[model samples]
Target: MNPVIVIGVLSGLVFLLLVSGTSFKPFQFLGQGVIKILIGALFLFFLNAFGGQVGLHVPINLVTASIAGLLGIPGVAGLAVIQMVILV
Candidate 1:
């Protein structure tokens, strides 16, 4: 998708890894990853819901950027899945 969204997803994934690197628990890391995905999904929903009237139509792109920027590829994928779930 948009570059910003890609960047956001990448960033998000990186942040997830960086933050989780310190945690000794594997489950905690997985949970953290899941949370990131959920956050991305929620962001997309809100963006889609009000982006048009609020002049935030590029919400998915924005969220992708944020997530990518924070988490990275995996995060982006998770976000994508969330989006798909919302769509279908």
Candidate 2:
């Protein structure tokens, strides 16, 4: 198992997985969720983008990220409500 051959094989497998749809559904969903949470976090940041107007700053962290990842948009809404009712 030469180093070059191992790397090439790994790359080829990754390429194949990327090219093939329905090959591994769970991984695809996980990948999408990871990207979604990151983007959602950014959206949360700017949710209160204004200095002092309509700014909803949901602290971006593991718990929030997990909530966003698992519950999607609803999770964000829930977080907002929770923040308002409790933290504020």
lDDT values for all models: 0.65, 0.76
Error of 1 at 35 (Å): 1.0
Give the TM-score of each candidate. 0.37, 0.54
- The CA lDDT at 81 in model 2 is 85
Clashing pairs in 2: 48-55, 48-56
lDDT of 2 by residue, 10-47 (tens): 99999888868666788988898888778777656655
Q: Quick one: best TM-score, which candidate?
A: 2
lDDT by residue for model 1 over 1-88, one digit each (tens)?
A: 8999999999999999988877758888777876776676666666557545744333455557558446755665565566556654
lDDT of residue 39 for candidate 2 = 70
